[model samples]
Target: MTRKTVRIAMNGVTGRMGHRQHLVRSILALREQGGLELADGTRLWPEPVLVGRREPALRELAGRYGLERWSTDLDAVLADPATDIYFDAQVTSAREEALRKAVAAGKHVYAEKPSATSFEAALGLARLARDAGVKHGVVQDKLFLPGLRKLSRLIDSGFFGQILSVRGEFGYWVFEGDWQEAQRPSWNYRTADGGGIVVDMFPHWEYVLHELFGRVRSVQALAVTHIPQRWDERGKPYDATADDAAYGIFELDGGAVAQINSSWTVRVHRDELVEFQVDGTHGSAVAGLRTCRLQHRSGTPKPVWNPDLPVTHSFRDQWQEVPDNEEFDNGFKTQWELFLRHVYEDGPYRWDLLAGARGVQLAELGLRSSAEGRRVDVPEIAL
Candidate 1:
């Protein structure tokens, strides 16, 4: 049986995430890794039709990838009978409208995280996709990271017996764009563009926590803008309206707690910028980018409160380095593969719009908590 080739129409193909991460890293790189073979034992390569506002940019991208189909009109691409799926990596502000259009056209949809800025908007998109009977997914890429995979294994193996809490330290110093060029997009600092760390990242935490422990019952958080101004690619300065940092505490089911500190201002002092420390009754584990350290209760040395003594026995000793099992690719690419597999082969892919909405919920609640000076209970998704 010949496998059905999935024709993908990518909206916002020239944007930062669209060009570097989603298009180049995910779609192109995944094909290089090895295209998907369906359940019927037929091979398929994602045939993409690049859609964007700029013709020259689209042409350049298309030519670079040997893509024959490219267009500037999104509606035309959506209306094309050849398009099997619509992939969106557009800005958050543009996502709901584009997704609604695609779903109305009866196309399967795959999109980047924080599907929309607000929870209600995300829920509406989810309902639209469901009503259209289209397969839908949002990127939840962190779960595929090797370090997180190892952490999940530890949790599943009962290494972290009666898990008490989890701590995450995520961020690095981002350039101000005045002296040095900003590492992220300039639009990220603008609220109207759907830019903020809480909205951008909390969904990632939601899935991670849900996967590792359980559902998050509530969240208490504070979101702040550390840098008030930033420069764009062209060196133009703009007011930074989005929060650059977020401190959040998630209350998980079964009484476990997760604390997430996400910022763009902190300096990285370890192997990777992102790290997680898990503490349980039996033992504790600290996982950095490629390495993990384990300290069992039996090995935990008791010491008096001394300010001068070297803290040697506290969680230390590097475990074996975890090598990348999949072909070298960004986290987004790995997630893209999973979504493709889910769509074509019926592989397990639970990271749907509901999951995406949960992230938005966290961000919304976090902002509310910060403004109201109180904790916010996370609301359950309607569907």
Candidate 2:
């Protein structure tokens, strides 16, 4: 088998998600696993060059990982003819400019969601990549997750006879950075810094619903900052301008209604931090991050609606668990492999920049709906 090496310039890896998920678990893990095998019996190896703002962090990460390449100069990295791919995990505000430069540099581009701060910019990036003829993709990691994959299999097997509605709950309380330091960065709560539950999570919701259930036709959302004040990294209080919580109702193309609540203020009460309950004509399924349980029409218990009396049926116990027949890989890593295949052998990759633009569009429309206090229709986009 011929060995093919592709150099990847990874940006903004100092951030938590960038560091852990993309750089460590996805890219480096693939390297440690002897690279990815392509369809043509070629072992496609990844050579990652760390690129970021801080030189100290980049050098430290590279040294810790035994990587030789680490650079604070994005322009120099992009100018290198050896760089085959440019991956961005930067903040929403910084993403567009960097991506534009990457596309201009004639490099394959892959990045995290909400491609840009606004729908227009995101769409612009899609157009740019399309016109530039570079193999582009977005990190739609949720679709590759174990629970969602099982749920998708159920959909494929016609387990849900006629899909009716979906209910999603996602959130966990983030500390105010006072006594307990904030788990999330302070920029997440500031609107100027491209922060908000709507902008951050609506993109994920868009792709998940579009891929698994149906395309979102319209959205109505109530976005608000539940906590007005929060301490920054330095333990200084700042007015949290971004919306901490968002309650959204989405209408899908196939007549399915999806209601999702995303927040950073609410405490988790479910099996996972994020969970989706999908109901259909024949059955209903609840899928979390790693588990899926379903109850068919025949197995579903009929309960008496007596408010004054105690509930008799074991509702939670009624659902049957979906067993994992196959081992599940890390979602981010799985996507990375697929993207690599797409770049090398011209493999089928549907999650392009346009899909990412759709996600950003949903987020933009969601925020608009909240501000106008009305449902906003999602318009189709074209280059």
Candidate 3:
């Protein structure tokens, strides 16, 4: 079998999501599995070159993985002709410039979203990648979750006859760092550092809604800083400038209304930290990260409304669990494999930089709606 080695310059792997998901679970796991085999039997092997600002962390991580390549200088890494892909999971404030340099170097670019701090910059990156004729993509990992995948299958099978509305609850309490250490980085709470629930999560909601239900027509949102004061990683008190919570009402095409709440301050009361309930004429479904439960019109429970009476039926027991028809792998790994195919074998890849820009656009509009106290129309984005 023919073997092709592709070197990936991975930035920000020292960060939580970057290290755990992108590096360990996705790329490294793929590497351990003897790389990805193409349609014609050619194996595509990924060699990850760690890139970050910290020397010690890079050295330690590279050494831990038994990998030889690691670098603190991003420019030198990008300039290497051997670097076939540039993957960025850096902070939002620093992503745009690094992405620009990578695109200019003619490397295939993939990055975590919000790809940039604003819609303009995200669109610029998309256009730049297009003009450079490079294969580019953004991480839309949530769409590959088992629950969402089952939900997609249900939609394809006409389970939801004329979808009406969707309700999504996402978030768990993030420690303020005063009592317990904060779960997320301190920068995530500062506005100047491109941190906010609206900017961080609206991009996720955009792609999920657009892919499953419909394109968002408009949005009305209210953003708030629930915890104004929080301690940093260094145990230093600072004023939290970014919005920790955002409540949004999104109007999707085909008359589906979606209400989603994103927060870093809310306590989780559901089975999963995040879950979406999609309602339709024929049936309804509630999907979390790993499970999806469906309630058909035939199995629907009816109850008469009474002011003072005992509940008649077990409402929670009514829905049936959707069976997993196929084996599911790590979502990040799955996407990484697909991206490799797209780059080398010319496979279909829709989640390009433009898609990333659309996410950023929704985020920008969501923030605008919150500020203006009015519903904002979502303009169609084009390359």
Candidate 4:
């Protein structure tokens, strides 16, 4: 069977995610797969035409990747008949405008998470795409993690019967810009640029929570800005306008509860950088990024709570390495492939703008809860 090559115009090609999705994922990785060839010898390759605001950066990126087609003019790129899709990894502030232009030009759209700073803007973008009759997707890379996949299998198989509750501990101490080189982008600490831990990460948690347990019914959150000011890349001090840490409690259907603690100011002293522990009436499971620990009903044991007592329970020993069955790419790269297949093959792609809007809703609710000192009910998003 003949394969169709989908041409992609990549916006923000000079940015971090743009470089990864365009040069590494779309160009190199997909090319290595013989253009998304199936086991049965079918192929679907995406030809990338890089686009960015800076001509020098775009030219440099194009030369580095040996890409013959590149441009700084978004309008011209959208008007080109050869482009079938508009890919965006632009800053959150620029997404709505860029996607509006792309949909107006009749191109399918795919973009990074937190698709918009506001829920209304995200809804508008989704409606615009739907009205234009174009496929659309938002990156949900955590769903593709191998460890999470194992947990999903366990849940499906009833390993954790009658699940009770879930706890997520995710964080690592990020250096303050004044003391050491800041690890994350400067805009991430500025409210003007839609920077905040809740806005940036809750979307991931929303999808994970919905996928694992159920939809969130309500959220009560407490958010804090630990570092009030930070230095930029140029070593100039600037006020940190976004919260660096957030503690959230989510109530799911069926009386189940989930607690999430996300911070950029805490050090990791655990087996992995991120850990999720789910407790149930039948058994309990603890999952790290690369490992899973299971304690079934039969293996349950009671131990002393004395801090001086020698630890007897083999809690850490129960964890085993998950065998790799298929070659898995990096999280971002994996989502890119799925989005590509979703656009071309009509695959099951549900990470649409509405889902992205839910993320914005959660963030907005969190902020309101913090300010008003009360819990916020998350209203359902109508697609």
Candidate 5:
């Protein structure tokens, strides 16, 4: 098979998501597997240059991963004509300006969301990329999840006659870093650094709900900082200005409502860290990160809310497991391969920068709903 190398300038490679997901698991894994196969007996190879602020960190990462290229100066990498793509997994606050610069330099751009701190900034970037005539994309990794894929299949197969509502429970307890070390980074608790549950999880919920049901028409949210203060990575205490938990209700276009509770302070009680239960007229299904269970109308048990008597039937045991028909890859890697195909081949990619802006818009609207204690309407993004 003929092979083509697409040189990628990857920024924020020193960060957790950037280094692990984008660099190692996706791009490098593709290279090790002899590149992505195109339909026309051709392969696309990802050639990435590690770009970051710290040269030492970049050098260490490159050497550890057996990479030949590492650059601290982003401008220099952008100026290089060999760089075909500029990928960013940096913080949401830094993504907009970096994307602008990358687009101006005539490179295809892709990044993690919420793409920017605000909707205006995100839509502007989308518009700018469109004007620059570059292929732009955003990371919507959850859509490719195994469980969600199954759920989508059920939807497509008409397993549910008429979907009614969806309830999503996501999150696990994150240590305050006093006695035990925190799982997430310290910046996630700081609003000044663009960290909050509403901003982080709303984007995921928006896309998930839209993909499963329809576009979100409105959002109502309640946000709270459960732990007002927490210890940082250096063991220093700092005030947590961002919302640690967000309880939101999104109204979809088809009159379906999705209720989601996202928090860093909550304990997991489901099959996975995140789970979604969709109730419909004909049947119901619950999906986690890697597994899905379904309950048909004929198989569903009748339960009576009797406080006087002890429960006899086990509710959890009534549901049947969904069969896995195909092998599943890492969700991040799946999207990366599709993005590469969209960039090089004539692959149909709908999750563009405009789609990303919709995510940002949902987050922004969710915050507004929380602040004003009212439902906020979501407007369509033209870009």
Candidate 6:
């Protein structure tokens, strides 16, 4: 049994997504499971160095996870020749420049998505990684979700004979600082701070829709700041310039339409914070974070439309719940394992920076569509 360690420089891990999802849930979890196993019985162990701006946060995270490496000197770590992978979970505005530096340092690159604020910048990062000959990837965690995986299986198994449409409902009411403490960071409401519902959620929607149905050919979006003013973390009043909500219709390659509504101002009434319903000719399914329900055309209840009669049948109860027959790992960890394998073994890792650039392109065009009050065509990005 042969084993080796791959040193990874993790930047901006003090943040929520980085610390919780990437470092703790994914990397540490992998370490706990005795690392990733390869086909030839070669186990790949990850030696991750936690890099951040704050000393206290870095120390706290390392101590909590029982990790050995922690550093505030990003430049020093980047310049080090031993670091194998450079993973960035920094703010969107800072991602492009930091990534360029990482590629220049000759490190395999991976990062959180909406890789950059603009499509050009995102694509440029991909080009840089390509030119540097470094393995690269972006977090596409939704595709690895258990519910979505089951849906993919069903699709492959021909459960849904002819897919027709997809409707996504994603949102939860975020508290303003007036009464309750704001759940999300104050920067999310500020446009200058690289925040908006469109830029944030459209990327997820783009990948999900593309992987499940087909490519998003066009988008007709309407984005708005439902709450114009809100109090910040310090009880200071500020105008929310970025959009808090985005309603969009994505036209897929095969004419299958996907409608998605993303919001931070809406109240949650559904099963989860995010859910997608796919309707097909043979069957239909609704998938959430960890669960999915299905209803075939044969099992669909027939109800007579009568204004005088009260509704008798429970339509919601008709759908059968999809059972989890196999083990389901954390979505972030799943992708992390796959990426590590891709880095070590050249596995088929599809969510590269170019794919991430397409997501940014979709977000940019979505915003454009909303501003111009017209549908925007999504042109394919040349690799």
Best model number under lDDT: 3
lDDT (C-alpha, whole model) for all candidates: 0.84, 0.94, 0.95, 0.83, 0.92, 0.92
Candidate 3: deviation at residue 245, Å? 0.4
Candidate 5 regions with alpha-carbon error over 4 angstroms = none
TM-scores, in order shown?
A: 0.93, 0.99, 0.99, 0.94, 0.98, 0.98
Worst 10 residues of 6 by lDDT: 309-318
How good is model 3 by TM-score?
0.99
Give the runs in model 1 whose Cα sits over 4 Å from its true position.
1-3, 309-315, 318-330
Report the backbone clash tally of model 2: 0
Error of 3 at 47 (Å): 0.3
Residue 47's lDDT in candidate 3 = 93
Q: Any idea what lDDT model 2 has?
A: 0.94
Is candidate 1 or 3 superior in TM-score? 3
* Local lDDT at 296 for model 4: 83
**Residue 358 in candidate 3 has what lDDT?**
95
lDDT of 4 at 50: 84
Higher-scoring candidate on lDDT, 2 or 3? 3
TM-score of candidate 2 versus the correct structure, residues matched by position: 0.99
What is candidate 6's lDDT per residue for 118-140, written digit by digit as tens?
Answer: 99999999998898899999999
Please give the distance, in angstroms, between residue 282's alpha carbon in candidate 3 and its true position after superposition: 0.3
Lowest lDDT sum, 10 consecutive residues, model 2, at 309-318
Compose the digit string of candidate 3's lDDT tens values, residues 1-383. Answer: 99999999999999999999999999999989999999999998999999999999999999899999999999999999999999999999999999999999999999999999999999999999999999999999999999999999999999999999999999999999998999998999999999999999999999999999999999999999999999998999999999999999999999999999999999989999899999999999999999999999998887788979988667878899999999999999999999999999999999999999999999999999988999999989899
* Per-prediction CA RMSD (Å): 2.3, 0.8, 0.7, 2.0, 0.9, 1.1
Which ranges in model 2 have alpha carbons more than 4 Å from their true place? none
The alpha-carbon deviation from the true structure for residue 338 of candidate 1, after best TM-score superposition, in angstroms, is 2.8
